[model samples]
Target: MAQFDSKFHDMTEGIRAVASLADAADRLNTIVESYGLETAAFLTVSPVYEEPSKPFYVTTYSPDWVKRYIEKDFFDIDPVLRHGLRAVTLVDWKEIDLSDKAVRTFFGEAREHGVGKHGITFPVRGVDGDRGILSVTSNENAAAWQAFLKSEARDFQYLAGEFHNAIGRIQGRPRHQTVCSDREIECLKWYARGEKVKRTAEILSLSPRTVRFHLDLARAKLGAKSLAHAVAIATERGLFFQKLF
Candidate 1:
């Protein structure tokens, strides 16, 4: 018991140490692989339904699957994800009703894309209304799948919580702001170019305090956890391509 506890501790610590979202995704893949699972994904939903959904995902699924999933906007209707988002406890895929035509079609496509036959989703409810779902899938037969879940479900929940907390720590705060002023845009550009507040202030002939203020506003507008995340969001939206680097 002590040995297993130690190992779990080490694993969660490694997750907390990840430096980037991509690195965190890779780590999730590693974790699922270690557990003999086929694939896994951690998904976060934006509170406002109409807001442009930023890529807040970590998944071990194939690129083809990822692209198709996005192109189809299938997430809005995915039974596993929809339930997990609202479910207070872990949701097992096998237990859910699959009688609906749309649900059947969705699962059929999922299997074609190499998603496994069995799965479970652990919902994570965080402070500040942030929510996420950690899903694990496998190709195992029904009996074996149930046995595996009985043994591993608790541990999976713990790992999901750790990963969520790590991501939250990196993100700094719950992002919701979505507008930036002209000066804020300027500050973000300079910051993206590796300009510190002091250097950017000098270049813009503004005080360091003013430069920082603009950057902070931009970060909030972008709903970024940090300036680095703000830069990533801007780049994703073609905000950086407007000006020559």
Candidate 2:
């Protein structure tokens, strides 16, 4: 029990030591390998809806497989991704519906590219509506895979949550605000100061249409529901008036 506790503590510390996305990716790969898995992936999605924002993905998948997956737009038909999006707990790849032809084809092709024959996925939902999935895969046979999962599933789930939080810290606050542009920030700032779009545009020497465009972009980037919401989020993130008072 003491040995297990110490090892778990070391694992957590290793994940927390990740200083960048690249480092996080490497650490995740190492963690999976330690469990005798062949590959692992971490994917984060914003605005969890039909057409989510561009997902952030880091994986030990072969470059060829990754390129093919992207070119074929396989995300739409991937059973793993579909299940991960809706599942609240750990998901065994076998639990996904494989009756669909597209799903079968995806798995067949993935296997041909050296992807694992068995895997488990952990789905996470953030307080702010962000979603993420962590998957670890192995080429082992069914019996061995099941036995391994029985022993390591709990640790894998813990590591998945740790990886997500580490990524959040590396990404900084208001995860969506990482994409806010200068113009968007300026528009939000002026709007926060009680300026209308027209007045803000005049102050910035731009057209009202242009000002509204920036503000709309800011709202979208910040995942806010409205202009007031956008300004409020930006203000909370200290994104407004960075140079001025």
Candidate 3:
């Protein structure tokens, strides 16, 4: 997995301190801005297996645009929103065939109020029929946007899950307790690779006892009966990223 940087460390810490959904949405915007994206939205609806609920959103979209969207009942014609609700993966704007006149006009009106020309939406499905969307927009040209997506798609997808889980907790839904700390993940990475406690310590420049301590914390948070089981849980959730160079 990737070596944790100070900026990423700061982000994890910030989430831990998030006071409300609006705070978390703002944090989401800040993270995307570093990638040259302009704004973001987090939406909650129902998964296809269940009946849909009135969608709720925490977004950086302009108030006028959001109001217009609701007043016009735009979700009925919103290609992005319609596809995103049932999408299992990241949905690039270009992937949707926007040949319909109504769909084009909807997005065109959105741009007039501040929506970016290009965007991507990540669908996050949670337990108890909970479904969420994390969408970010940018004004970058196709080539540059493609390059950004190639390198960052996985990261944005992970962020969507985090946002969904965090909002769920705030809304009284079941909370995911398996979110590991940076150091906890680092120790787990080595352990997953079959490193013994001592070797893992050397790899992280820490004492063996310290490495074991972090591993134990990770194991407990994951509610795994063993360290290996914890690693398996993390792997299943795609928790690990590329290792440091």
Candidate 4:
């Protein structure tokens, strides 16, 4: 493996240069290869109206495995996914509460599909109520796995955060536009530039509620599930930057 610092620096720059979600996902595969891992997956689920919307996932796992996982609806019983939803910190696959038969069966099936016997997952909470998990798996023995974790867990955590942020920037959006008004566009523009809701409201000389209304409208128009997602879509489509000038 390359020196940790150098590998991390390279991965950071590489992810940033990616122009689309597909490219970002490809870069993640490269990063995982550097770590000698068998697979890596980035999964995000955004909440809408207090319920989790559909999951958006990018993974280097085999198509057959992914197909079976979805066909069987294994997500509901997969300990990794279940724990990742509520975990605030890194979780080793071994540490998950897998007393349930369904959970054990899920892992057994995963291993049968070459999904690796060991892994660690980082659970991420985005600022706009988006949840994500960055998981890397290995088929290594216990001793080797422990040593690798001891030496590189921190670097992997940093990589996970960077990978998640990169996906946030480059993920595609719906092509349809719902005809946003000038106020909605203005609010989205400021929000995309990293302004807080209150700050954006102040800049636009509008009430916070009004700003939120416009932002929500903009999100709906763009067919985005979250505010950050909307901003990403808008930025990617050059809607905001073009309007700013």
Task: List the candidates ranked by TM-score, beginning with the highest.
Answer: 3, 2, 4, 1
The sequence of per-residue lDDT tens digits that candidate 2 reaches over residues 66-87 is: 9999999988888788899677
Q: Candidate 3: misplaced stretches above 4 Å?
A: 47-52, 177-231, 234-245
- 1 versus 3: better TM-score goes to: 3
Give the alpha carbon lDDT tens digit for every residue of 103-147 in model 4.
Answer: 788888888887878989977655455667889899889999999
Task: Tell me the TM-score of model 2.
Answer: 0.66
User: What is the C-alpha lDDT profile of model 1 across 56-91, one tens digit per residue?
Assistant: 788888899899999998877799887988875578
Q: Report residue 46 deviation for candidate 3 (angstroms).
A: 4.0
| For model 2, the run of ten residues with the poorest summed lDDT | 173-182
**How far in Å is the alpha carbon of 126 misplaced in model 4?**
0.9
Give per-model TM-scores: 0.65, 0.66, 0.69, 0.66
Instruction: Go through the candidates in order and give each one's C-alpha lDDT.
Output: 0.75, 0.76, 0.76, 0.75
RMSD, model 2, all Cα superposed? 15.1
* Model 4 CA deviation exceeding 4 Å by range: 1-4, 48-52, 172-245
Q: Judge candidate 4 at residue 118 and give its lDDT.
A: 95
By TM-score, who's the top model here? Answer: 3
